[model samples]
Target chain A: MESPSKTYQPTSTPFDVDAIRRDFPILERKVLGKPLVYLDNAATTQKPSAVIQSITDYYTQINSNVHRGVHHLSEEATNAYEGAREKVRQFLNAGSVEEIIFTKGTTGGINLVASAWGRKHLKAGDEVLVSGMEHHSNIVPWQMICSEKGAHLKVIPINQQGELDMDQYTSLLNERTRLVALVHISNALGSINPVRRMIEMAHRKDIPVLIDGAQAAPHLAIDVRDLDCDFYAFSGHKMYGPTGIGGLFVKKAWLEKMDPYQGGGEMIKSVTFEKTVYHDLPHRFEAGTPNIAGAIGLGAAIDYLRAIGYDSILAYESDLQAYASEKIGSIPGVRLIGTAHDKAGVVSFVVEQVHPLDLGTMLNAAGIAIRTGHHCAQPVMDFYRIPGTARASLGIYNTRAEIDHLAETTRETIKLLS
Target chain B: MNSTKVAENSIQAAQDSIIEDFELLEDWTEKYKYIIELGQVSPGLPEALKTPDIKIKGCQSNVWLHTELKDGKIVFSGDSDAMITKGLINLLINVLSDREPREILEGDLYFIDRIGMKQHLSPTRANGLASMIKQMKIYALAYKTKLENAN
Candidate 1:
């Protein structure tokens, strides 16, 4: 919220991005005979060696399912898995371990809320409110359940700068508004919403909120207790961990009330033809043999972040983002999208007369990996009345020199295209 | 070059010509620039023909193709949302347009690989190219049926 990197405050590691880049082996790889400049962290991050090694170690040493087995391997594996959940609990500063439910990814977590919570409570005439800038993962699940329940899906609009129009958001809320689902940060535009304030406003009306922290978790230091959101969802892959693994942090009260999303072995206390009593808390939500290695890898990623200190990450990322934004924006025919006052490590822009796919192809040819499409946030694209914008999203290890190259190559690409 | 010409070998000849043209380009960037130029210069499809029914499914890029059975030869025209894809559409049009339905339906379509276009394409775009070819072949198959029925 404070002006990010206005006056540079030294990180604990003192902004040594080169050393951090070394932590990721993928950064060393060349693409098309040129060194790779990966700026697609918003889609998914490149795994650090610590995270990669953690997965290998889990498979090589302690490769067993957790919770049920009584063997020594099982206990070690269980400890590793649950330890990862505890790490997530600490990462978000949630109330307790009971609130942390591991799922497939951010989409799985949001769908859990939509199916379990929506089917139980939402009535025919209810309204499910979401911001216009949400990824399709956050939007489509609600639309599906809302359609089935005969509930209406309402969108809170954003301005040209991509900030939410707070007055409209307030006016849209009423007795029919059952829940407010919003993205903590826009994947398409890099707009950081004032979610704490939005959460407070929703809580005032007895309406719970779900923060899609898929983008936020990778960049910001998330504190669910501090934000006081009813539910938080994030993907491990976006945070330099493995794919097919993520977490959902539910308020304990909601966790107690919401029905089990899936009927599976681990989620059951006792299975009867008459009635199946569900397992308590996190187990009730986790239904299958979880991604064991992925969870351990996520824990390792958390450890990696902790070692570097999130304060350092925040400071360095802010500085990098500001410098990249200025550099990229200075290019002729490049129009920056989502120039929100409070932004993180994203730069979405459009070049005059060049399609995003062409631009992406051009960038790829030059050995930069950026996302170019609707970015799974088509509503934002529809609002802008464009097909897609080229997006360069940052990670903790990104250097200013790489950004300079990106900008330089982009200029050359535009020249060649024109 | 005639829209309804009765040339049988011209289709494959045109495919070879495209491959030759692409081989003259230095790199993927230059090849793409040529593709974009071809796409830009290619004729636009009528807005009415850009319907859902004519659209090729599973294409990462949106592509529409329309076929006309004229003078016993099938003429195909199409459009695409992305420039690279549009260029691909143009390439397909250049190769198969104004050819007999039977020749087009059974055409080699191997110039893409010969030109190293397949290697240059991203996986999604490669899928789009396949879909484009499939759509063009389907059009040819339809015209083949109509020609046989008339005969």
Candidate 2:
């Protein structure tokens, strides 16, 4: 009575993905004498020429120090760097530019929150609630801080579908819960949690929440105002930009109360032997000279994405997800790992008797690159009782044709392996 | 008494033979196929001998190794969960298993790069290969110390 394409909901926007693919030069290359089908976007997306040019533009022209420098080059460089912060503010829909802090990556952003905000707010007996499906970046930072403060670190369990157990999460919240940090979308399993509901629940108990948006930023549209979350964090490289750059979106209220993440130049207004006063908002958190070119590149990436429009990206990716879930999911010997009803840009799976590493290697030989192993979320793998899953995560540029190739390749590999 | 042992020529001849055999293979796929075939001939570790203490640490695939000293030769047996890794382990065992501790410690093992294996292996497997060789050398050094003490 049902059809396979029943779940495939076509989006409103008309997408020209072939034109988009042409923008990324690496997509035109070959992997193993065959066309490269890059399904590793969740690991790191391929940068477009626009983003690459922005980086080159920085080096070729307007290359200088930011903030403290008075020279012409410094002003130009500082303008570009600060302009990137404004882009991030607009990108996340955060309240102000002052609320956006530059970081090394998502790990650095999470660590900054744990160190600066956690030190002032948390104490012994307080609990930091995190979901079971967090990447090590989210888990370890909270773990480090919780352990340091003699506070307990509580976990929100996940069901077999890899969705967070809301009943358990709600039950665990109490007067002792100081804060909650959850992933926007799980990198390992493509489950998108009901973060708005969870954030509201936490706010009821006066507990601030931090959403790790590393995986979600590239796939979904995020609005800090709509989510009403206290903090949001994401990396630039995962969004088709340069590496060594990411941003943390903290609410102005939280910024006012929290101490500086690091003590160094620029973070301080004036330094004396016995007296030191810190700067305001974002700069208070970012201590050293920031990644000037990387931030500018990230800004360019945002501009490119904005031009394509999120609606088009969403529609295209959903089409890819539905197609992948059906085609790749239906293959013989392939057991789809995460089958959450509300899923996003990834299809994680395993073939019978074939280790993920072997499967990935065989696929690589076929010139299809899919990520293998724990995906830096070992707890998620442990929960699933798996060594790892071979993941094919989608980006805006991925096509349904590529999905068919993936399914065909996987089916052939399974037969060969079996 | 030593249960089973190969001839003196067999241990050293294995490396030369493998290099010659790999030269016949045309591409990475063929080399990999040959490697998987080689895993079939590997002297798998006994259930009792597959102890956690002797497992290779850095390999992405789990590999258990056991070693012994017979007539001053460093006898070895190993197994891996993955066929390709198992084959690679078997190839190592064939070449260096029964060679003298000092010979293994000083052996070049140039055949890794000579047969284009260095280029073919993935980054993790390359690290695993280096770790395997390092672990083998560590075992030889221990035996070398024991042999010296016995003197």
lDDT: which candidate is best?
1
True contacts kept of each: 0.40, 0.12
Write one digit per residue (lDDT tens) for candidate 2, span A1-418.
2211111112222478877787888999987577899999999999888888788778887778889778878888888898889889999998899989999889999999999999999999999999999999999999999999999999999999999999999899999999999999999999999999999999998999999999999988899999999989999999988999999999999999999868888798889999998987789888888898899988888877877778888887888898999998889788888888888999999888776777777677667888999999999999989999999999988988888888887786666556
Q: What are the per-residue Cα lDDT tens digits for candidate 2 across B8-125?
A: 4654456778889998987665676677777767768877877899899999999888899999989988888777788888888888888789888987787899887788678878
Candidate with top TM-score is: 2
Q: Flag regions of model 1 displaced more than 4 Å.
A: A1-14, B1-13, B24-26, B40-81, B148-151
Give the alpha carbon lDDT tens digit for every residue of B1-151 in model 1. 4666535567767887787888888766677788888877888687877999988898866788888888999888889877777888888888888889888887888889998878868788888888889878888888888778889
What digit string (tens of lDDT, one per residue) describes model 1 on residues A1-418?
A: 2211112112335457877777788999988777899999999999888788778777778888888889988888898899899888999999899999998899999999999899998989999999999999999999999999999999999999999999999999899999999999989988999999999999999999999999998888999999999999999999988998999999999987798878898888898899998888889888878888888888877777777777988998999999999999999999998999999979999999777787888778778999988899888999998878899999998888889989997897778667
- Pick out the ten consecutive residues of candidate 1 chain A with the lowest summed lDDT: A1-10
Model 1 - which docking category?
acceptable
Off by over 4 Å in 2: A1-14, B1-13, B41-43, B68-75, B98-103, B138-151
